[model samples]
Structures are given as C-alpha cells and as structure tokens.
Target chain A: MSLLGGGIFKGMAVTLRNFVGSYFYKDRLTTNDYSWRPSDKLPQHAGEYPKEEGEQLRDTTTVTNYSRNFPMLLHDGSEPMDTIRCVACQICERECPPQCIYIEKSTEKKENAGGKPQFYPAKFDIDVSVCMSCQICVEVCPFDAIVMNSQFELSTPDRFGGLLLRRDDLLKSNDYYHNIHPEEAAARDKRIAEEKAAKEAKKKAAAEAARKKAEEKAKADAEASEGTPDIQEDAE
Target chain B: MSLELIRDILVATVPLLLIFPTLFAFTTWLERKALARIQNRIGPNKVGVPLTRYGGRFSLFGLGQPMADGIKMLFKENIVPRDADRLFHLLAPILALIPAMLVLCFLPIDFPWINNIQDSVKAFMLDGAVIFFFAITGLNTLAVFMAGWASRNKYSLLGGMRAIAQMVSYEIPLVLSAVIVVMMVGSLNAAEIANAQAGWNWFIFTPWGLAAFIIFFIAALAETNRSPFDLPEAESEIIAGYFTEYSGFKFALFFLGEYIAMFAISGLAVTLFLGGGAGPGVAALPWLSVIWFLVKIFALIAVMIWLRGTLPRLRVDQLMGFAWKFLLPLSILNIFIAGSALHLLAGGRLAGLDEKQPILRQLMEGANPLVVAGLWIGALLILYVAANGLNQLSRAKVRPREYKYAE
Candidate 1:
C-alpha cells in the first residue's frame, strides 16, 4: 500500500524479467560472444565461396566493423613476386606521433618501370609498446603500404622482443585485410583497378603518337632522296 | 562411548557434515551464476574442466572453482595485524562457524509421515529446538563482536556494533513470528510442530501464517546479514566489516559460516511453515522426504538470491527501523490474530483434527476450511487498513520542499 517498498518490488520485477528473458530471448542476452569462428550463413556475398542450405547465420557484415588500432605492413602481389608495399618513403615515420616506427633503406637497388633503381626498406621495426594506436601511420602512408590491423590480442610476456614487431611480423596478406575490413579492402581494390586501367590507356596513346612521327620521317627521307637525284641529272 | 552408540551418532551426523559443506559450496556457485544471469552476463564458466578435451570438444564449467579456492586458501599465508589481539583474532572465525554448525543440528529433517516411527534417525532432538536454534544463531553476534574488537580497526569496530544492533533487533521479530506456529502446535518440539501441519494443513495456507512467514523471512534475511540487510559488511560503507583483519583461510571460514547460516535458517523456515517433508508419496517412499525437503530449501535460497540481485543494501537507520518499527509489530499482531482465529474457529482444537488420524480423516475434518478462510480474510482486511493508516501517519510527518526560480 505504501510507496516506500514499491520501488524495491519494481526493481525485483525487472531483475526477474531479465533472469527469465536471458534464457529464452537471444536479444536479451547481453554477453558479447568473443568467439572468432564466423557462422556459415554470415551475410557473405559471392566472394570466392558458395553457401550451403539454411546455415545458422549472423549478419556480421552489416554490424559495426572492428576498429584496427595497430598498423601493419601490406604484402602486395602473390607468392614469388610478392613485395612489401613500403618503399622506405619515411612519410609514416615522420608523421608517427609517438616515433615508434623505424625504417632503413636498402643498400642494394631494384629496377623500377623506368629502368632506374629504387630502394626498398632493408629494416623495418615497430616498437609497439610505444605505439599509441592512433592510426597516424596508416593515414600517412602514401603508397597504401601501411594499414591498421584489427588483431588486438597483442599481449606479450617479453618486454623487448615480443613488443618490438619486425617487418615480417607486421606483414599481412591482402586476403587477411579483406576478411577483417571488407568495405575498405573492396574500395582499395577498385582504386587499384582504375589506376591500372589509366596506366594502360596512357601507354597506348604514347605508342600511337610514336608511330605517326616515324611515318612522317620516312616520307621526308624519300622526298630528300628524290631531290638529290634531280640535282644530279641537272648537273649532268 | 559404547560401539553401538558411537555407530548411531555417526549415522546421524556423517551425512550432515558431508552434505552441508558441499551444498554450501554449490550454493555459492549457483548464486554467482544466477546473479550473473540476472545482470545479463556469463558467470564463472572458464575455471574448471569436466573432462578431457576430446575431438576438440569439452563440457567444462567452473565446477572445480570452489575446490580450487579451498586449496588456494589452505596454501595462503594467514596474516594477522601487528596490533591485533592475536588470540581472539585467531579464534573469531572459528567461533563464527561453531554456532552455524550447531544450528544445523536442531533442524528436524525427513521425519516420515505414515510410519509411526516416533524416533526416526535424526541428528539431535531438543524439545525447544525452535528456541535453541535462535539462541545458537544469536551467538554468531558475539563472534562478529570478537572479530571486530580484536582487529583494532575502526571499520571493524563499526561493523561489529552494527552486527550486534541488527542481529539483536531482527531476532525479536524472527522469534516472535515462529512463536505463532509454536502456539498453534502447543509444543516446543520441532517434530511435533511439523506433525501438527501434516497433509493439506500446512500453516502457509492460512492468512496469519502467511503474514508470519513473510515477517519471519524478512527478519531472517537481516539476521543472516544477507544483502539489503547486510549493512555490517557493506563494502562501500565498511571495508570487510568484522572480518577486516582476517585473511586467507580465516576469511574462508567466515564466508563458509555466513553461507551455511543462510541455508540453515532457510531450512528452519521450511520445517516451521512448509510442513517439513510431508508431501504426497513421501510417506510411502520415505527417501522422497529428503528430496522434498531439499527442494523447498533450494526454492527459499533462490528467493534469497533474487532479493540479493534485485535490492540494494538498506542504510543503517532504515535497517534498524524496519526490523523494530515494522516487522516486530507485524509479527506480534500476526501471533495475536493466529491465536484468536484458532480459538474462535475449530473450537480451540489444538491438535488440528488429531495427528494420529489417517490422511483422509484429517482432510475431511481438519479445522473447517470455510470458517478458517473467513477468519483469515477478516484478519487480512484489518491488516490492510492498519498498514495504510501507518503509511499516511509516516508521510504526514515529512515537510515538502519549495523551489524558487532566479530571474
């Protein structure tokens, strides 16, 4: 009858409701399952795999994508030709707020498209303990060489060795990136495709111009020869 | 000291010793898991393995957590304060457990209904077991005082004082509520009191009995220092209360004592109001009595856990006031109502249609259900009006505050 104890009962009723609802209702259960296994029917589009019938699914693609704090090196191309995207540009190193990244250009030279030699990083080390995970390195990388990684289980017992991630340790496959951040990975792939198309178009235009110049030169040479023969006949 | 006597004593007490501690541990696990559910989280399911991980699968939960905790406690260094009274400090936790164990012995569990086995195998039979149970439980207050005083800490001292005040105040209502049942049965023996409510005559069916049960239950909560009434050991208020100076195994002992006491009191409530183990088929299948008794206790304990999960701790003054001002009067009035109702209806037949009669006869002539129900309804109406009046009286004393706006 009194309002004094009514609030307690209301609170108790709320707890009871939660206790029951937790068992029967999926939405009511607030535990964030940290299991890494993705469900088979997870809103996966036609990527490289086919779906089976009536798979237990989760709409993970629609849900919030995991934020990548630590930066990692992207390994470009497949197997034998695979090269580190980083060309020792030093942009990410300079822009890094915490100055955790270290880069050393290689003494040996590798041929570029123009036949000039270019240097790649011989030593790349990230003292991850000092990294603030602010994503400045990822943003500053002009070559699209560095990107933030979503793998957050970086706990290490070793202070010096474990925390200091080397170039090999930081290298991740493009497939790995696509799996974690599909939207970003797709956007990057589209941009790369556009760039390749533009480069091919430029090469074709240059070849056509070269052919026209060569033809004109050939005609001029014939004309000069004809003029030389005429002068000889006149002199005779 | 004879071999037969020794065997008889062992038969009575061996199960109590083995079962209660294990139940207490399981209760702790259950409470944690249930509370986590109420809060919408997965509780402790990562601690222990049920079996070997075969074929990359295992059905493991934190079942071994209590055992692990016991082992950890055993290996821990028991720390005592530099300025503490070493002797009392050492003895305090042990003292706390003693009364709790003693109280368990007084409970009359699994006494068969049909079999005229007057002296069935039981732990201990005291004529005034209800009184003895309360008295032994009361000694836990002294243990709290010892722990508080010996610790030489301010928080411990405050907790000890609060424990004394809370336990003493709540014990009155708790005992008074039980007194109504004792009055109805006209015997101090727990077995007689239980037998009096045989078949469908469970005291909980009556209005006065229900009111007494509620009062007794709430008081019991305070008495056991459960949440909402657990001001003495309130973490935000006092460190660890009376057990502030205790560490390791000593702290474990205090914990064991508190949980065991919670269960024992709940068991007492079942015995007094819920007709002990007198359920259908319990007489024929005597072993079923244990199951029924345990089920009732577990239900009551679940309610306790629910209360813990739901309500926040009461403030010191509110705790004391509720015990004295509210519960005491309610229980006293409940006793009076039950007494009068018993006298007017059924012509003061203290036996409740003769306990010796068969179940069918007891059901047919047991205290005229209509007249008993009518009396209870009348009493409930009176209680309702009284509660409403008191509510108004309390509200009238408070002055309303006025607010002014600044221009």
Candidate 2:
C-alpha cells in the first residue's frame, strides 16, 4: 500500500505539471514552430544604416532564429573590426596547429633605410575548415592579430568554396574592435598612448643633446680663429 | 476509398506521427530544464525570441538548441574508431532507432484519422497490437547489445551486458503484469483493453486493476532503463554506457531512440491502466478522446521526468535483487489474484454476495466475511512489511565515499 501510494503520487505530480504547462506554454507544448510571430517595428539600430533610409527591417524573430549570441546581436551591438592591431607579426601563423593560417609580410628593397613603416601583412588567410577552433593562434598572437569572433552561423552548402576567409574578411577597423570589446580596447588604447608619449620624449632629449654638441663645436672653431681658446688649452 | 474515411485516417495518423517527434523534442527540453532547476540554473533560454513586439523580450533559451545540435552533428567530422567493428558501429544507431519508430505504427491516435481505412486491406491496421508492441520493444535490447559490442570499449561492453540482463529479467514481470490485464479484459488488442476500461471503471480504480497498474509501471520503468533502474547508462560508472564511441548524427539517433522508447512506454502504461484515450463523459464527444489520450501521455512523461530528477541510480546487484526478489514475485501474485477475480466475475460467483443482498437472497449467496477480511488484511500486512524493509535497506547502504587524488 505504501509502495502504491508513493508511486502513484510521484507519477501524478509529473502529469499534473504537464497538464498545467500545456495551457500556459502551448507553443512549447507542441513540436511545431507555432511560437513564431512577425512584428512591424524595425530593428533598434535601423537608423544607423545609410543605405536603408526609411526602409522597414524585416521581422525574423521566430523561435527558430533565436540564439544567445546571435549574429544579428553582434552586428547591432558592436563594431568588431575597427582596430588595426596586427603588426605583421608571424607568431599567430606559426602557432596555428592546423596550419590553416597564412601570412605574407611586407618587405623593403633595402635594409635599414630610415624607419619607413618597415612591416605590414600583405596577405592573410584562415581556412576555417581545417581550423579546429582551439584558440591557439589567438592566445599566442603577440600583436593580437586574431581573435575568435562570436558570429558562429557560418553555414554554406559549398563547403570548399565558401569557408576560407581572406584578409578582407578578417580586417576590421579599430572602432569596431572597441565596440565589441570595450574594456580591453580601452586598456590597450591607454598603453599605446603611454608608449607613444615616451618615444616622443626620448626623441626630444636626443635632439637637444645633438644641438648642444654642435654649439660646442662652433664655439671651439670660433675660438681657434680668434686665438682665445689657447689659455684654456694650456691650463688643461 | 470513401473520402471521409481517408481524411479521418490521414488526420489521425498525421497528429500521431507529429506528436512522436514533438514529444521527443519536448523531452529533451524538459530534461534540460528539470536538471537545470535541480542545479539552480537556467537552461536553453537563448533559442528564440518573443512572438509579440511589446512582450517582455523573449528568447527560447536556445530552444532551437536541438536544431543547432542536429546541424552541428550533420556537419561534424564523423570519425570511426580504428579498433571498432566498423560495420556494426555504423549500423547500430540506425538499428536502435528504426524499431523504436516502428513501434509507433500500432498506436491508435483518436478515432481513425481516416475512418475508411477500416475496410482498406492495404491500410496500416494492427489486429493484435499488444503482441506486436511487445515483440518490437523486445527487439530494442538487441540494438543495445549491438551498440555495446560494436564500440570495442570495456565500459560499453559492460553497459551492454547490464542492459541485456536488466531488460531480460524485467521482461517477465512486465509481460506477466500485462498478461493479467489481458486476462481480465479477455483480449490482447490494446484498443479492446482500453475499451474495457470505459466510464469510471478505469482499470486503475479496481483492486486487481490497481495491482496490475503498479506492477506494470515499475516493470515499464525497468524495461526503459530509467532510474533507479538505469544502471546500464550510469554516467559515473559507464561513461554514456554503450554509446561512448558514437558521435555526430549517430549519437543524435541513439538519443532520439531513447526518448521515443520512453514515449512508447508512457503510451503503453496509459493504455493498459489509466484508461488509454477513454475520458469521463467523453465517449459522447468523440473528438475529445484524442485530447484525453495526449493528456495521459504527457502526464506519464512528466512522472518519468520527476523520477529521473528524484531517484539515484541503483547498483547492478541491488537492481537485480530488487527485480527478482520483489517485483517478480509481487507481479506473479498480482496475476494470480487478477485471474481468480476475473474468473469469479465471469462466472457470476460474486454476484449478490455482498451485504446489500436481500435477506432471502443472502442465505443463497453464502458469502464468508472472515475469509475475505483475512485475505485483505494479509495482503495489507505483506505490503507494509515490504515497504518498511526496502526503506531500511536503502538507508543502511550509505553513499560511497569520494576518493581524492591530491590535497
């Protein structure tokens, strides 16, 4: 009798929940995508798009299209491609375990030809197929050349043709990068500004030292011409 | 074919087919939600958006999670372990799923989706559905074995062995319990059994009917490999049991099969005990019968989920002991009682034997009150002792101590 009571009550509790849930969450109760409801209001950032002036955004907010980090959310919330953080560093390419990454560094005809922006990556490619998403490249990148993008919906029928990403696809502006990762971007910007200020100060000190040396040389030449430096030379 | 009948069959079957997959999906969601609730967390909330523009911004919590999962599996690199039985590994998940899907064929959803199919020789009409349902469910064990053997892994092999033993052992009680049901109704057809339980005479409400329902429910739980009977797939022990080596769409197929089997068992339980699709005062309104059937299935499914959340997995030896020593004997006794009661009912031996009989008829009835009371009291005492013993035994078996590798 106890066994019967426990089992019956336990079973009844479960059924009661389902019976109640069926009414409140009816859309979820069925297998079909009945949760879809179209709306007329455009996306919040619709005004930002210059090309779509006065045009309404299509409401595709179906249950099927919802995702936590949806691609649409990424587009609307952040500009992820703004920062030119890559400094033609080959570290990301070297550390990529899959060898999916390729980089062509900019080269000059002459070595040590006055600091004229010595290096730039001329070509870059990341074969997403072979890339295992291990984040090794991102972790090892010294100049932060690569980072994992949250846009995961990269489905395409022609796998071979559509998956490989070129430099153009990878390239993003500093503003976009700041928008997506604001905290990291702010910290990086402060660090870079400090380094630039230090470099300018060092350059100013060197120029001042050079000017002092030239002035001493001119004074010595004038003293020789005038025979006035002979007393100090004899004393030394 | 008469157009009305054809339409009826189509409508009936389409919902049934749709319900199967829908329940499968919902079960996945329900499991996640329940597990999350137990762990004090939210699960799968990022799947979809709110239907209305002004409604509190909604997301299905990754409700399209299963879709994404399916797509990922489809596109994933399918790797077969080098040491595995390649042919069997490739064939196992499909083998497991096909029989599960096939079981849905005999299920009657509502009235004939097409009433005309009754006359069509080529229509999907299962004459002896009870036997067919049992035969197919039995075949599911073979698929489990194939999965274990194909993997070439020790954990999987052990899991397979446990599953086969557990299922084979429980099959007796399960069949015997249903045998009593069939004996009482004098029919092996599921629909007939359901029809027999019409009105308030639902089998669960009767003395023998209640016993059979309890026995059937326990046996069904064991048969489905659900917890405390879920030793076969005990995660801590077997690492996903027989499917350790499977991945991608193959893994999904195994998952789909398990849920579908769960669905079938729930449907079976409802049909056998809780009056299948029969509703109170619902015979007059035929359309409401389908709704009643769905309600029962969902209720049963919810119970399975709750059990999963509440119970711990039973150890292999303990599980076998419980099945053989307790459930088996109880089920056999239940059958005997049912058989005797049914025989008496058929022969009208118990008719007019009650205290309500007239004075002149009472002497002719010749009912023995002491014997009846003794039998009832004896049965009650046995049940009480068994319940207390089980409780004490479970409590005495303290949880295993956790081993730490380092400080």
Instruction: Give the clash count for each candidate.
Output: 0, 25
Give candidate 1 regions above 4 Å deviation.
Answer: A1-6, A32-66, A78-82, A105-116, A173-176, A192-236, B46-62, B111-124, B243-245, B346-371, B391-407
| Candidate 2, position B258, lDDT | 85
What candidate 2 gets wrong by more than 4 Å, as runs, is: A1-236, B1-15, B49-57, B119-127, B343-407
TM-score of each: 0.80, 0.57
- Residue-wise C-alpha lDDT for candidate 1, range B327-394, written one tens digit per residue: 77777777788767766765645445654433222333656778767887899887666555655654
For A1-236, candidate 2 gives per-residue lDDT tens digits of 24424664675566556545654664435432223236444222312222233344322222112111111101111333222345567887788788988888767321211223445556777787787777777667655456554345466687876787777776655555455555555676687577778877777776666666656765787776865452222110
In candidate 1, list every pair of residues with a backbone clash: none
By summed lDDT, the worst window of 10 consecutive residues in model 1 chain B runs over: B50-59
Chain B TM-score by candidate, in order shown: 0.89, 0.82
What is the clash tally of candidate 2?
25
**How much DockQ does model 2 earn?**
0.04
**Where does the lowest 10-residue lDDT sum fall in candidate 2 chain B?**
B355-364
lDDT of 2 by residue, B1-407 (tens): 67866676676567666778877877787777765544344556555533455322356565665665667888877878889999998898888887788777555555544554554431234557778888889988998899999899999999899999999988888888787767656566676677766665576765556766777888888888887788778888999888888888898888888888888877878887888788865878877777888789878777677777666777888778777877777777776665554444334554434422222122223445564455455554554466456545645554447887975
Tell me the chain A TM-score of model 1: 0.67
**Chain B TM-score, structure 2:** 0.82
- What docking grade applies to model 1? acceptable
